[model samples]
Target: MICPRCAASLTGKQRSGRICAHCGKRFALDPAVHGKGMHDIRIRGIAERATDHGRLKITLTQLWYLSRTRNYAWAEQDPQGVPAGIRWLVALPVAVALLLCAVLTDGVLAFVAGAAGCVVLVVASAMRHRPGRPPRSQIIPSEETFRQLMTGAWSTAYGRLPKGVVDDARPVPRPRGASRSRASAPLSRPTAVILCTDRVAALFLTANDIPGRLGAVLLEAAGTEGTAGRSDIVTGALKELAEYRSALPVVVLHDADPLGVLLAPLIRAAQPDRVVVDAGLPVSAARGKQGVVRLARHNRFADAEQLRTVAGLPEADAKWLADGFWSPIAAVPPRLLESIVVRAVERALAAPPPGPRHAHTNGFLTWPQAPQTPHARDTGRPGAGTSKREGTSSA
Candidate 1:
């Protein structure tokens, strides 16, 4: 690891204390204290990738997922079940030793040892753990810890979070019975309405003031019904917006997960006459075929079969979703996602008013700017932004 302050390579000084030997600056996150993977270099790299070289801002939660070291898939049959390979690797040596003993010594003791080995194999195979997704479970450090580390530890050490890093996880005061209002003021004719499904993405939009900058009304698929409220407010706002400016196109942003991918369709279903564009993460980026971050969750949705009928997912896509695996839109690099949403809004505005169901799935090739532009995050290091989605991963 290198000292973030002086850019000097650490020479075993950080192990004993936070003070840098070369720069003498007291750093916040000592790898010794935070774990092997937690260090200044890693954090800097993550921020760079997430923020797209300071052109975009990344949420702390999205930073949390981007900082994760492992890639995993969910198995609904057993979320906590150990992998068969692990069991075999553990028992193989013992079984081989027991067989050798039984063969070398023709005694009852050897037979008993072999029997014990068999029992050990059975115990290992039968072992069960508390049900949990390998990805995004308690075993993985909580977002709170990551938040504190960045806010309390990292900030204290570095003065503040790196450029373009936003802490979206922090709680904010909400209006009481706010949802009842259901967008009291209808949009005043923005170019388009952005309907984002994931609450995090909605928060991201607010943290960056994306709606204001783009002249769009941003709405979440959830919330604004209670507490902050519900989708009814979203529905009401859409209806009002449609009525106010019937030709105003709606841009939909969502995760690549099965349920998330269908949110655009849901919006279109409710407002059949309007033009809705989906600029959210696509399944191709989350399917692991593209080598993006595809994480697991307990997605035992009763409507598992509806993925195909509702979202037009292929058999492979449907099967992947039915397995309780998904990729969050947060996984996409912050700037790239912004560009996608922006481009989607532009597309929505340009798209002819929906005379029929004008539906299409957008991918990386059609997502953002030309290749000459800078790259945003997801992968460990900053590289050229390719036609393929960059920094694509799920927690």
Candidate 2:
């Protein structure tokens, strides 16, 4: 057990007194709420325990299935820490016996006996409880699970759920005609465009004023055609991009998943001449992050197009895809992701002009220089021409 505030190891004295000796912070302990050793638990420790326990249970269930069915090949190759050699050693003798019985009994009786044996083995494996193992009813603390428990506990203690959680649950009432307000004026052409793989991320950026801050246009790569009236938002963004004076930098932001990795390539394919920079939640980022939630291999959310796109990826990325693990864009904290985007945009803004051959190779025209503001156009100095004359006027 450790102090949640300072990560100092908790002592027996502190545990008994309900105080963190290092941080001098007090934490409550309720036998009903925390169960045994309540004082020893940390908030993060609870979540880690829960997640580990869940994964362990799932692995055990899979192993039981493999063991009961006597699937030697799959069982031996199982990657979830199953005891492969033990499984193989147990299964081989049974398989050999089944074959020998068929030879001895001339097949018919052997089939009946094999079927009975299989059923008994499956049932027994499922029902058997090892004496030393913890019971299934034991609670495993997890961050998400603990958070939910704390929500209920807080409600009981304070007569209401936490204000943040309650507010998040309530629908935010948008002003009537808000959609019309968004569509009323044509958007100014931006210096760059950011394409997000999902609407949730795009909306998050918009809500945080990222687009205005970066002087970039934000667009969702998918679900535009399916969002009913919101399709106009996509159309308008595209229109602004098409009308931009320069070949504005087109940056692709996505999850560390297969689909996200392929977004830059997809955009490049659509407009072969444009310079598309992949601002990533790359596979490396996911691999490095301890807090990242790695989804199982063979995600249902992945489509055939995404699968095809990843086929030509580098060895490591391709292997990540084959392993069926992906980290979502949402896994990275919003602030961190925003900072990444800002840095990428700044780099693009500072880049020198692309070479003529590179820019014109695929029949795309060279990018025009950025358009000057109306004030700059008028006097060649922004806001200089519109100054009002005071008592002493300019000659």
Superposed Cα RMSD, model 1: 9.7
For residue 391, model 2's alpha carbon misses the true position, in angstroms, by 74
Per-residue CA lDDT of candidate 2, range 1-395, in tens?
Answer: 56645668776676555566888765544433454333324322332332233221111111111111000000011223225455555655676676567567855798876765575455444442222211011112333444444455434444542221112223323323335335322246477778776555565455445666677877666633223433444444455446554467776677666656655555555465566666767675455433333443333344444555542455656555545555556434444556677877776666544465554221111221221211101112211222211110000
Candidate of highest lDDT: 1
Local accuracy of candidate 1 as per-residue lDDT tens digits, 63-165: 8776764343434443455666777787879877887787778679888877877887788877864443232322134467777888997888778887777
lDDT of 1 at 62: 73
Off by over 4 Å in 1: 11-15, 78-142, 171-186, 223-245, 289-291, 300-304, 356-395
Global CA lDDT computed for model 1: 0.64
- CA shift at 122, candidate 1, in angstroms? 12
Residue pairs clashing in model 2 are: 46-141, 46-142, 47-142, 47-143, 50-141, 297-324
Candidate 2 lDDT score relative to the true structure: 0.45
Lowest-sum lDDT 10-residue window in model 1: 381-390
